[model samples]
Target: MRIIEPVEITPALAVMEAFLVQPSAEPLVVQVGQAFQVASLLTNVPEADHPVWLSTKSYAVGDVVMLEHRNYEALVANTNKNPAGVGADPPNWLDLGPTNRWRMFDDKIGTQTTNPESIELTIAPGRAVDSLAFFGLDAASIYVRVVDPYQGIVYESSVSPVSTDGINDWYDYFFTPVEVNEDFVLLGVPAGSYGSIEINIAKPGGTARVGALILGKAAVLGEALYGTSVGITDYSRKDRDDFGNVVIVERGYSKRAEFDVIVQTSQVSQVQRLLSKYRAKPLVWIGEASYQSTILYGYYKEFNLVISGPTASDCSISVEGLI
Candidate 1:
């Protein structure tokens, strides 16, 4: 998503990744320049990012992925033994609701091989990926090789004989962190002269079903969309003059709105850092400002000046809306 900043500053693009976690847990979305405070993102370990759309991998219910330039959540997860060719939409994936971002393909092609399958993923041209996450079932082994654009094989390792038995038995395999400034990354059972692009997302030949393949660390704040202690910090209405006396025009809110928010948490830094990364993006606020709406979207605020004392609970945040 793109974020608009103040007239004095230029706009910035917010890079975000989507993922599926336990049904009970929330998925975290990363903002541009946010500190690596989350353990998953901070730890030099490979972890799941979001569910990967493995053309040949299988998925179950409640999984997530980005397909065809859209976010989708799986509902009734079922894989088609025979899937369509590349660039074709499979079957059975759905959006979260009448208005949602989750999606799934109706038909998923099964991996033809029972051995290691290779998947090659490419990072953005100038971007670097630090970690890799693997989620799946019934994989006997997972071998990872990270190659640089110029230098080959910067990092390599393999976990033989993964623990999970099958799709019914969900499990995950995380890799250690590595430097991936190169544009390409190769992952899967040992590529071993597969005659494929080594740096891109590579999957070894295998029948093992891959549920999710996140590239970065886990999002600790989850969505970072909700907050507490909200109140109308400022308000104004429109008025016009008609004839001799002034008359009130329709009471319209200003594009520039303000709100006082207090975030209560054991970790004040978490809330503070979240607000900082949230700068210059469209944010949703739910409270009196919403005015009969569950959420008031299209607000942008710069980094909040957090007031923290001895305890993690005492934290203050002021949100500045768009004008």
Candidate 2:
């Protein structure tokens, strides 16, 4: 899986700039939106940034736009119809957002620890997020905390945690493109407070494995962001009224986005191993503007492959998003 790095912000004032420039024992300090600016700057970004969705005009391929809290792209290209209706057609539009719940996780930290029975991820986001989610965490009495450079520990989990096998009753089933069918839980932080977020997980037992992590405004993607991007066959419902009249309610979608992943037969195992790392956790799809917004959560819905006589050939796998 490709790692998405955070952006760098252009400090608004000289004092903040000096604080950032000078390495110190003190925690880094900055206001909100600055970290977002930095993250946006240090990347091979798009030449033409699309406008946030609008309804008054027409759109073409590669033209970015957002609607109803989701971003989208014109896949097949059409004019009058809205993006909400557009998502119903798999061949027409695509949704994009922070689908990868673990995008904020720094994989460089190494996902597990045994010597200390814990792992601390040093994150300097320069902003505050409402909640974060964890997937496939195998630990007993897991303790979590978020420390700010200036304020000490701002967020921490007091409730004793159950092992991964015992969490079916507590955690929600979050999806990740590479990883499929795993247990995950979302943690909420204090309200109206901001900080440079650093997550610390401590387990008393010998070994602890951190599967994946996601940080953002919404604790749950399926709730905060949910819509169909492709393979939506039907989205209509009907009910009978008191007088026997028909009533129809249009909800969201029967979402199932499918895509073929082609790889050589020799690399099949490698791809599978990488996919297994995610193990059914939500992934961020930053492929395009629209795809990033709507397909906030996805999984290895299904896959198929036919090896042709030991030589390098195409092995097809399909990705499915929130059902």
Candidate 3:
């Protein structure tokens, strides 16, 4: 949430000399909003009182650097006033200022439970991915776990801790990707553990500004030919050989200026029904050209049909006759 402005480097001898004067022997910690300079281009000036001209290099806008401060106890006391007293049930302390502070509790805290609604994912299959990436903002740490259908954990990542400073809105967290040889897989983690992905203005530190945790599946496109089409008049399976040969033929014509011609199985309706049950969208294509002449197509191959569309539509697709 801290907006840091960048500093321009200029060759000013007087300005450079003033910066070389160290504050104290104790190192000062450059925290979230603090600023400091690094030593660069040191030169010897024999005539000058301070013979060394230490070029000061400012910290980058979003750089998170640790300062070596010896007086940490004193600094913490000054910065974080009203330090909580020691003991399981310590006495209430009075706040002296409006500065934000945190207390270390002795009691063990319970891990928060996350609902399914708090999880988001991008599905990618067939890609060479060693890990998964999660993005969020203002989080102490992130925890990841893969669960099976029986509510059993398959894999889990160590609580990856990240500093909250310099992380403005959202950042990416990567985890090892899981391999799936089956039909389906479930991957999830608590939203808080992954940094809140919700968007809100009022809750600045409330992990609500984090956007959707994009669950991407690293996948590669296979040899499978997937597409949608329309405008078919007749489609049926033909005769069978000694072993029963199932031949399919489709015939249709488009009179519109723009029409699409698709060769699919007659079970397109069934495919659409299954997709609807899962609240998915069925793939459909629009006609692109006008065909006054009738076209006929045949397929002697075997394939499957997968209809993907909106849950409200009644349509299906046949994988056969498509290849």
Name the regions of candidate 2 deviating beyond 4 angstroms. Answer: 1-116, 147-153, 163-182, 191-194, 219-323
Candidate 1 vs 3: which has more TM-score:
1
Would you list the rank order by lDDT, best first?
2, 1, 3
Cα lDDT tens digits, model 2, 224-253, are 113323454355688999999999987544
Better structure of 1 and 3 per lDDT? 1
Top of the candidates by lDDT: 2
**TM-score, candidate number 2:** 0.32
lDDT of 1 by residue, 94-159 (tens): 642211111001111111111234433322212223433332223444555554323455666655
Error of 2 at 293 (Å): 23
The top-ranked prediction according to TM-score is: 2
Candidate 2 lDDT for residue 169: 40
What TM-score would each prediction reach against the true structure?
A: 0.27, 0.32, 0.17
lDDT of 2: 0.42
RMSD of each: 21.4, 22.5, 29.5
Scored against the true structure, residue 282 in model 2 reaches a CA lDDT of 47
**Model 2 residue 306 lDDT score:** 49
Model 3 lDDT tens row, 110-198: 11112222222112111212223322222333444443212344455543223222334434223333221111111233211111121
Q: How many backbone clashes does candidate 1 have?
A: 40
Candidate 1 positional error at 157, Å? 1.7
